[model samples]
Target: MRIAIVNPNTTQSMTQAAAASAGSAARSDTVLIEVTASTGVASVESHVDEAWGALSVVTEIERCEASAERPDAYVVACFGDTGVSAAREAAAGPVVGMTEAALMTASLVAHRFAVITMPKRTLRQSEQVVRNLGLEHRCTVLAVDETVAELAEGSLHLLDLFTAEGRLALDAYDAEAIVLGCAGLADLVGPLQAALGVPVIEGVAAAVTIAEGLVAQSLTTSRALTWARSSSPSEAVSA
Candidate 1:
């Protein structure tokens, strides 16, 4: 099966890191198609950035669909699950978002989970994502004093910050699991998990496994209602 991992941001390094994380969880027979959005902000941090990122996601999926190696499924590798709905509407395959996949995976392993993301500004957005997914009661969103660019640098000091935050989540919030809230933090899962001694869920890996499962079960996005593609203005007029 072929899976396309779409990094909504234009950052090539982040895309590569996310794809590598996804690759670690994928089956040997599964092929991963990596796509970095051709036009979007350097990193998706704000709502405006998310909007642009989402557009890039739809564009990439449409481009992929027109290619010879159309993927069997797609993973939107943004922690906010940016452009997921648009991607779903544009693709014929199952679309998985990092936030939803990671939160859901965390829920399965532990009853209460806390999401650790960066920049602090996206804390509300992360909270809303959990609420939108109906997991608000089971999850908490925590932020660190760091930006996506800082996280991308993959510094050992950033790992220390994450470890400290994870400890806070576990001790104060009674969180049983910790969810990495950004795709850029994919590579830190092992070290963070080791430091926290609890389940540390990375959305890229979780999403890959979920996408693979969906494909193996022969399940694709349901085009019956909400995700159904609407006719274009011209087509609608003709009809």
Candidate 2:
């Protein structure tokens, strides 16, 4: 199966990190197509940022669809699941959002899970995502005082902050598992999991695995209603 992992942010390092994590979780036969946004903010932190990032996500998917090596599935590697709806409309294959995939994966393993995101401002965005997926009852969203740029740098201090937040999720929220809520934090899964001594789910890896499974089952996004593409003017007139 061919899976395209699209990082909505313009940062190449974050895209590399997401691709590496996806590569680790994917089957040997699965081919990964890595793509970074050509235009967008450095990191998607707010509704404004997501608004800009969404365009890049759809553009990349459209570009891939026009290529000879069109992917069998696509993974939107953002905790916010940036441009997922638009990407689904633009791609011929299944599109999996990292946040949705991670939350679903967490629900399967643990009764309750917590999402730890960055920059503090995205807490509401994360919460909205959980609600949108109808997982609000089983999930909690927390924020750490770090930025996506800081996460890309990968420092021990950042690890400590994540560890502290993970413990809080376990203790205060009664969370059974931890979900890292940013694609930039993909590389921290092993370390954070070891520190928390519980399931630490990274969205990129979960999304990639889910995308591969969807392809294996020959399932693509349904274009019957919500994801239906608008017809061109000529096609509309012909109809």
Candidate 3:
């Protein structure tokens, strides 16, 4: 199966990092295609960025669907799961978002999960994902005074800040799992997991794994009702 990992931001470095993590978790037979948005912000750290990023991501998905060799599934390489619904509507296969992937993965492994992400500005977006999943009671969203760019730069101070906040979340929320709240945080999963002595869920990894599993099971997004097309029958069938 072929999986397209699309970064909503224009940063090729971030796309590379996300692709590396997704590639590591994918099976040998699965082909991974990585793409960075042609037009969007350098990084997505706030609601405004997310709004613009989602548009670019949807365009990328539509571009892929227009390709001669379309991917079997598409994974949005942003922690916020930006443009997931639109991608699904525009594609013939599954569309996976990092945030949803991470949260669902954590929910399966732990009774309670805590998210460690950026400060108040973007915290609500992540929190809403938890609530929308009906896992609000079992999940806690905590913020760090850091940006996606800062984390992606591999700053030790940012790592330290994350680790400190992670520990606090474990104690305060009594969480059994720690979900990294940004795709930029994927590289820190191993060390953070080791340091916290619990399962640390990284969205990119979780999204790829879940995408692979769903593909292997021959499962695509259901177009039954929720994603039912509003267009004509011919257009809907083609979509």
Misplaced by over 4 Å in model 1 are: 231-239
| Model 2 Cα shift for residue 82 (angstroms) | 0.7
By summed lDDT, the worst window of 10 consecutive residues in model 1 runs over: 227-236
- TM-score, model 3 to reference: 0.93
- What does candidate 1's lDDT look like per residue over 143-231, in tens digits? 99688887565545589888988999999999999999888787688888888899899999999999999999999888989899755
* TM-score of candidate 2 relative to the true fold: 0.94
Worst 10 residues of 3 by lDDT: 227-236
How well is each residue in 1-239 modelled by candidate 3, as lDDT tens digits? 99999999998888888898898888988899998999989988788898999889888988898899999998998876888877787778888999999999998999988998775578888988888889999999998877778745553456778899888988888999999887767767888888999999888888988888888899998889787644533567999
- Writing each residue's lDDT as its tens digit, candidate 2 over 1-239 gives 88999999999888888898899899999999899999889989888999989989988888898899889999999988889988888888999999999999999999999999887998887887899989998998998977778857654457888899999999999999999988877667889889999999999999999998889999999989999876533457999
Cα distance off (Å), candidate 1, residue 6: 0.3
Q: lDDT of model 1 at residue 227?
A: 92
Superior by TM-score: candidate 2 or candidate 3: 2
Per-residue lDDT value at 214 in model 1: 99
Root-mean-square deviation (CA) per prediction: 1.9, 2.3, 2.9
**What TM-score do all the candidates reach, one by one?**
0.95, 0.94, 0.93
